[model samples]
Target chain A: MDHQEIIPNLFRTEYRKIVSVLSKRFGFEQIEIAEDIASETFLTAAQTWGLGRIPENPTAWLYHVAKNKAKNHLQRNALFEGKIAPEIKSATSDLYDGDIDLSPENINDSQLQMMFAICHPSISQEAQIGLSLRILCGFGIEEIAAAFLSNKETINKRLFRAKEKLREERIEIAFPEPAKIEERLSTVLTTIYLLFNEGYYSVSQNKTLRKDLCLEAMRLCVMLVENKSTGTPQANALLSLMCFHSSRFEAREDKNGELVLYDEQDTNLWNADLISKGGYFLNCAARGDQLSRYHLEAAIAYWHTQKADAKEKWENILQLYNRLLQIEYSPIAALNRTYALSRANGKEEAIVEAEKLKLEDHHFYFALLGELYTDIDNQKAAQFFERAISMARTQGDKQTLQRKIDKFRPADIPD
Target chain B: MDQYLLLMRLDIITKEAQPSPEQLQVYMKQYHEWVAGIAAENKFVSGTALSTEGRVLQSDKVPIDGPFAEIKESIAGFITIRAESFDDAAKIGADCPILNGEGNSVEVRKITSVNENG
Candidate 1:
């Protein structure tokens, strides 16, 4: 890759590494200081490399510079002397001479710790996700704002408030004790799941294809599974669920950036590697007796990955969805179960169940009603499709619904 | 090769208003990329971002606590580079990543070297 390409790739990969390392050394309260030093380090690299050749070991160069910068910060700042210095002095008298541990093991530990710190239950779920994107995933504020479909001012205020909460709580950037990990693990898992869903099912027209966030969420889930303490059955199940969903990304969207429903999607576009990984993790998840929503969802996604002509795929999906509804009764999940029912039994029975849901404000509900009405009544189908188009939040969804409406009505309806 | 000085100034009207960290990150990245491009062309030598707070010396031999009240802009930083000519230096300044808005710009000028012996 060229300089431009390499810099961004490095930013995605190394930005977190450097920040985690510095944050570990400086302590969580001075995370901003760590971030400043990391940002400056990258800026220095860009400047030096712009005028000259990139270093042979660019990662090493960054670590070396960042390490020195951290040392400088500790020595110069009076705040560090009060809390961090005594520990440093006790650990090593000559902080400058000795090599501070930015080892692979330490780096992983630090990032995992930072993840827990960011996902503390005291913070709002939105704030936790925002922090994850900004601090853990190396996303810019603008990117985070786009992800949430909010203005920059709102995003900035949210981050500022979240950081203030972190400070006020005096939260430490370390893994909780073994007994306490489970208490916060569920929130962390939920945040990761939301992050993945944001990327997988974004509502914004401009940012419909943010595979970066999905990948980042997967990476964090992998981290959770790798660590002995955090690697529970649910974590593995979540990873498995993500792998199954991500495996279908290529087939998820059409050329016009509109979603292709599962039945209409080209199965050939599914990723074999990710599907296999999903199966592997699913098996890993099954080892325990505990069943999470992730397990049920992964099972549903897995069935969807099967051949369209398979006799049992829809049946299996319906079963999983039924179980999922019992475990976690979300309206969206209920709506999805109706789709599975349409495939498993028939549209006539599914429509009866779907109508009882009375999800009046949901576009997908109207779209599903339009689909169920297609064989029964063309006029009603067109009306439902029109309502879906009107209620749709994104241009892509609106276009998809509009296309469906167009097919039914030969004459244009007056607005 | 002739030496040139690239002078930068802050055009921001509200001196007390600090940039959010996000905005700062964006500007920092832009500045780095621009400087890197110049360095790739083998023009960059040395530069440093000046602190916003500084003293100013007046003609009356008094070091006033300023960039004075009347000053609309203050010199933020400078970088020295090797350029072929004044025109070449000016051309290079076009890409300098000063935060653009009302009056942000890089003033490029050829610098005369006084150390003849070297």
Candidate 2:
């Protein structure tokens, strides 16, 4: 009962099971109620369990308390109706009649169903990710709002609208049919991938990387892999890609937190455990005949992870980027492939590819172009750097570009 | 146990000021989809759509054709649904198509019941 004394891991395991069970029992439409009751149950447990030894079955205790809270809510509603109050009493007493199993299998299936329902394509992509983090990952609204780079009010409106749409559409709590699984899975994977991307390169300058978001994404990936129904080769590939990328976090930035280019990062700082795990998942991804975009991206990460030096892996990285581009062509991919080309060939080839992209409007693109030009001793590139500084959105990015411009300034200008 | 009124305030002037029939048709389609979707999900309660024609009853019991005030402040339609709490009602209101137009908004407020004891 004294949950304060309980270990964090134990509490989380028990809490997740209880929450998943209650969420399923109350229906997805009653998610807020379920979450409220779960929160209250944990609060009660914290007070009661801390006074004594932890319960032998902490999960069951939490579930029972939550069920009672839900019954109390129903009774309160019944009282408002002024009907037979005794009927509410009977309902409350019958809360424990059914033996609801909270096994790992049941919880995983229910959570997976909830994830698919929340991530339905009918909802906007922003709403899908926001709802998933809130309902499935148990994130607070403020936290989700921060992750979205918006104010809490805007996020509240978006979430309210998303839930309303879901209720209005009567979106079923079920997985996509076998034939449509791959397509639906793509949306789900994309949400998880973007979730991790936000964690890796946070939009907020104050917090470069939010470990909470990264861990939540990894936890969700692990859940996907656990459930046989939802697990697929692409899911494995995405998990592998996340692992590979996360492994380099220790070496991603210097002690002062400035961005360290891959060529300058110390290879010894990479986590070997994560690299092996990523390689294993990548192998699992390769089992399927079809190759997904995640597969190609993971291959690229794997090449970087396994190489002794960035210079040795340039050609492999370029090939992977080429394959990735063929799967899904985007401005970001083209930009990245240009960087790889710079490493493989020279600044000239990189400039050609970079110029082909009509991304003058993008600050980072121009800044990178300026860097490539600087590599080739072109003073005209200083103008591009100046333009990039003007277009830069963040103070940090602007400062970095300004420094680059000053470093490559013409001889005629005073230092 | 909180009761809420989902007020759908429509800017009739904006709708009437539409430049083309195609725009009106598109707006109509959106409303139709919304009603159908809500009805299918059983979220629809009692509601009514008002005609564009406006009538004002003066103090002298004279009825005049008028919406003398700003057209932006008019209420076109509304529906009331039973919900467990204010949050539930707000969630239901989020999907209302009344707020979809160029300059329209849906306002959700809890309805307070009163007694004559005071």
Candidate 3:
């Protein structure tokens, strides 16, 4: 590849590894210093590579440069005498003897450690996601801003505050204790899940940016799953859930680029490869007796892949939804279970259950009711649809509800 | 051939002034291209980046820390190139990546010999 593609690819892929390893070595207290060294390494590479002569092994070349820069920083700033301990004074001397130990093992270990570090409970969830995008994914502030539909100053403030928290907490870049691994991993996964959803259900209309967020989530998830220390069954299940959702990403929009509900999506547009891969991960997640929320969500997402509209599929989905609500209740999940109840039993049963939810404020509740009453009572459906359209938050949501209302006239409605 | 020294200066080296690393990586490609352009014309010589910390002495003043004395800007680095005239050298300096903005600039000076070969 030419420099354009190659340089950015390296920036995204290598920047994280270098910064992560450096941070792990220097400790979180010196994270900014590590970041500076990492950034300078790339900048120096730019000047050298701009001469149109790429180092034979660019990654190794980067490691060497970063190592030298780190050493120079240590000596130049006297990091040991003032603040940093002799831990680095000794760890860094190895660079002089040999290499900086950018081994695959060390890099992965550092990155996985960083995944937990960025998800510290001290920061807000949004800030955690933003920090993850910056430090772990090597996303620039500008790109993170575009992804969040936010401006640079806001994102900068968020990141600056979050990094300050990491320092204040003295959060170590390492895995949690075995006893608390599940709890910590859950937080990390929650941030990853939110990051994925932000990309999946975003309103920015920047398709590439949205898709990139999902991809970054997947990359982070894969990192967690591959590492033996943190790769719990729940991690696999979360990865499986992401894979299933990403497989249908392309089909979410129609020929005119309008949103396509899952029921109306073309099966051919779905990626069979990802669907099977999702299944593979789901099976991997089945190992061990643990049944986290991710397992339930993965099962739900897995059933979603059976696009043939079979009664058996809906019944299984309904059962999973019931269990999911029992474990941890969410209004959205409850609303979704109502739809599954409709498919599994009948519209009348679903309408009764949905009405009992009394989620009068949420537009999805009205939309579901509108869908259930379409054939039996077009007038009722129209009223529900009208409420849904009015209550919808975005122009896109209003148009979608309008389309749903338009789909069922006095005839041609679902049973 | 006359040798010209082009001193690179910038008001700021980082934070708001520096582009994102990704942007800088791509932006630095222009410097490579400029160097290639001059090298092809046989005018390129050498370039060196200055360390931020050094001792700077002014007339009848206590020596000051190198870069921070001038709060307005830093003399980042310099490059020497062979040119036919001051105009040619200045023209070459015009393409240096360091001169891209308001306070950022390049100062060009022709090297004068004390003696023929001293």
Candidate 4:
């Protein structure tokens, strides 16, 4: 591969590993120093690689350079002498050796440890995601900003504050104790879910979809599932939910980058592989007695993926949605349950339930009303469509609503 | 061929002035590109990028402890290249990556060789 492709791929995979190893060795307070050494290693590679061919083994070359840089840093800085020297002196008597021990197993342990460190409860959810994107996923500040639909300055400040919090809290790069594991893991799973949704739902300036963020979230989730301590039933359920949602990714948007309603979506585009994997994870999640919201949501997503659009499918979805709403009464889930109510019951009953929701400000509330009224009352449907269009924030949603409005003629309206 | 020394002078590097490590990697790539351009033209010579710390001395005085001094900008590092004229050497120095902003500059001067054989 060309340098353009090779360098970024390396950065994405190797950058975090180096940071993990260094942070693990130097302690959490010295993460910036670790990052500096990793950055310098890449910079030195850039400086020399231009004059000569890239080294035969680039990773090894980076490790060697970073090792030497860390050694030099330890020797030069008095700060390291005070903080790190004591730890090293205690761990190993050979203080001057400066090996920094980045073995394969150590590197894996460090990265997994960092995953927990970034999810410290002391950090705000926003800051946790910012740090995860930067330190764990190897995302740049610009990329993180784009993912969050914010500006660079905001993202930079968020990351700066997050790193400061990491230092202030003195969070170690290690797994939580057994008693705290479940709670910490929940925070991590929620962050991953939010990350995936950001990609799946957000509209990009240049592109209609931001699949990169979704893929990164899945990649991190896979890491969680692979590890013994982190692979909880809730995590498996989250992964299953993600897989089911991703299976329908191809049908979410049309060629013109317009949002496609579920009824209009081509079922042929759904990925069978992901659907089967989601099924497997959902089964795995069923092994436990405790029912998390993820289990309910994954069940809901699974019902949506079924090939048959019969009343049975809708009934199953409606039940799962009901259970989910009971567990977590989010307006979005209630709004969705209203749609399922229309499918399982009828539009008339669904209309009564949807109206009682009193979610007047939500565009989807109006959109759902518009959809429920389509065959029943064309005039009311047009009115609801108009309201939905005005309430919509994104161009894609507005276009979809406008298209629905276009189906109704003025003559069909009643004063 | 005349040997010329290009001395790079810049203000003390501060955390505010320095790009974060993530950004520095990108700048390093650009630096590599610029260096490669000069290397392709066969005008490149050996250069060393200096670390931040060193001792300083005054006439009839002992060496000082740090790089901080009275000067607004200190000589950061230097490179020697073969050029026929001062203008040619200056032109070569113009492409140096560290000549980045207002306070940073490259001063090119011809170096006198004291080789008796020559």
The runs of at least 3 residues in candidate 2 whose Cα sits more than 4 Å from the true structure, single-residue gaps closed, are A1-17, A46-60, A71-95, A206-209, A310-312, A406-415, B1-118
Residue-wise C-alpha lDDT for candidate 1, range A34-141, written one tens digit per residue: 889989988888888887888888888888888888777766664555655555545442565454567889889999999999999889999999999988998888
The residue ranges of model 3 lying beyond 4 angstroms of the native Cα positions read A79-99, A410-415, B1-118
Tell me the lDDT of model 4 at B9: 86
Q: Candidate 3, what DockQ?
A: 0.00
Model 3 clashing residue pairs (backbone): none
What is the CA-based DockQ of model 2? 0.01
Best by lDDT: 3
DockQ of 1: 0.00
lDDT tens digits, residue span A51-106, model 4: 67887888898888888787766666645556565555444334535458778888
Cα lDDT tens digits for candidate 3, A1-415: 6555677889998999999988988899888888899899889988888878887888888988998887776565665466656566555555443435689999999999898999988899999999999999999999999988899999999999999988999899998899998888889999999999999888767788889999999999998888887788889999999999999989998666567888888899999999999999999988887778889999999999997789999999999999889778888999999999999999999988988999988998899999898888887898898899889876778888888777665454333
Q: In order, what DockQ does each candidate have?
A: 0.00, 0.01, 0.00, 0.00
After superposing candidate 1 on the true structure, give the runs of residues whose Cα lies further than 4 Å from its correct spot: A78-99, A207-209, A409-415, B1-118
Error of 1 at A188 (Å): 0.9
Give the TM-score of each candidate: 0.73, 0.69, 0.73, 0.73
Lowest lDDT block of 10, candidate 2 chain A: A1-10
What's model 3's TM-score?
0.73
List TM-scores of chain B, every candidate: 0.84, 0.66, 0.77, 0.79
True contacts kept of each: 0.00, 0.00, 0.00, 0.00
**Model 4 CA deviation exceeding 4 Å by range:** A78-99, A206-209, A413-415, B1-118
